[model samples]
Target: MGQGKTSLVQRLYQRAVARYWARSARSAATARLAVLRQQSQKAQDLRRHLNRVIAVSQSRLALPLIGSNSFPRPHGTDWAWRPELWRQPLDRVGIASVANRESLGAEVTLFHDCAVSEVTLRQIRNTREADLAPFGVSMDVLGFDGSFLSLVVDLPDEAVRGLKRSHVIRLDTIVEQESPLEIFVRLNVKHGPNTEQVVHELPVNQEVNTVEFDLAYTKLNEKRVEKAWVDLIFEGPEMNRVILRDATFSRRPRAEF
Candidate 1:
């Protein structure tokens, strides 16, 4: 009987040990699963933040370097300029159903005489290898019944400082259009009591369209030049999409005849 009792006690001890080990294993597995869930949640949150950072970085990196003021200039070029709209990003990216005297940026304004508005203006990033400027301006026109449509760009104060009659101002532009178009660049210089103006037709649908205004020809008052601007007039621009990829200015003295 004692031997039997001893055998039974051994069997009971074995079962109790087995039960304890089974419970410990379940607890360990539960703890491991909780740790896995916590790690997965953290990883997901990290991924979300990384994606946002990557998107913004890629967008900015894809564009041409900002604040780039480099362009080809003639020898002896006194002053060269790339407008703000082309050199950097604007506060507003685009506008639809544009109104008269609507301004795109601080420096550019749109003017038209249409009874109903049918124009859209947007700033687009230039990504092509041949584009020199970082940004470009795009215009969409449809069913235009306007007598005149023009985009005016106000020149900086430096453009008028030390003005003289012997200087020749050159306007260079790169334009892409859906069809053949006629465009004109009119340079206006404001003197004391009068404004001197000169108009030159641009050769559109070409690689580079350039026009030069010789101040020597215009009755420009040298001593009283206070401000200057350029008007880009579009003629019969109906049903057309025009993209002005680049617009730049440079000044040089005319060679003595």
Candidate 2:
């Protein structure tokens, strides 16, 4: 049968069952034995199917709404974005014992120098009212012996379109760590054969987690800009559980002096 017809039948069946229960509660004695027998038989036949539907419904409905791309952006912002991991569900929900050069989603990748990997990366649904993104990423680090660990997010073509040295790229994120840690944000702009990198120490301990990169400071060749990406470097992240509740990027022109 067609999906629409099947859904209609299910709704009608639910209405009839609801009415039956309401009447049964009022006067069970009024129910004839023949009708009761038929009702029992029908309910027994439908119980397994109904239970399956209920289970699937609960699982899907409990997740945050999908395809939510809206987020706060700065004034005069030409571009704003929340990475794919925070905007949609991944085919693979998580990774255990993540190795070097491993990736969670299409845009995010984990790179480390540890020999024996002891890290896990997972995508989680954000259900709190204060959460701006529909999804988040969680990382658990234990006994890490890596000299460097960072998550890289590749920006789409739109981020590099019409790029110029006059623009100031901004990074805003909400991170919760088990202990004190310093995180740094690096903006990489590939222009021609050379890549320009701008690094800023993310003030994660402050009330607001934000950092900006002024391209004017970097020797970026705007005319030859090809691609851009961001790196989130975690310093001394051993034995820590870090949840990146939200990460967003925005670009705006710097005000003239």
Best by TM-score: 2
- Candidate 1 lDDT tens digits, 1-257: 65446677788998996786566556655667776577567657967988999987776777567777888999989899999998889999899999999999899999999999899999998888688898999999998998999999999988778879999899899999998889989999999999999999988668589899999888887888899999999999999999999999998989886
Candidate 1 runs further than 4 Å off = 1-48
Q: What is the C-alpha lDDT of each candidate?
A: 0.88, 0.88
lDDT of 2 by residue, 98-164 (tens): 9998989899999999999999999998877677778899999998988999999999998999989
User: Model 2, residue 75: displacement in angstroms?
Assistant: 1.3
lDDT of 2 at 173: 88
Quote the positional error of residue 40 for candidate 1 in Å. 9.8
Clash pairs, candidate 2, are none
User: Which numbered prediction scores highest in lDDT against the true structure?
Assistant: 1
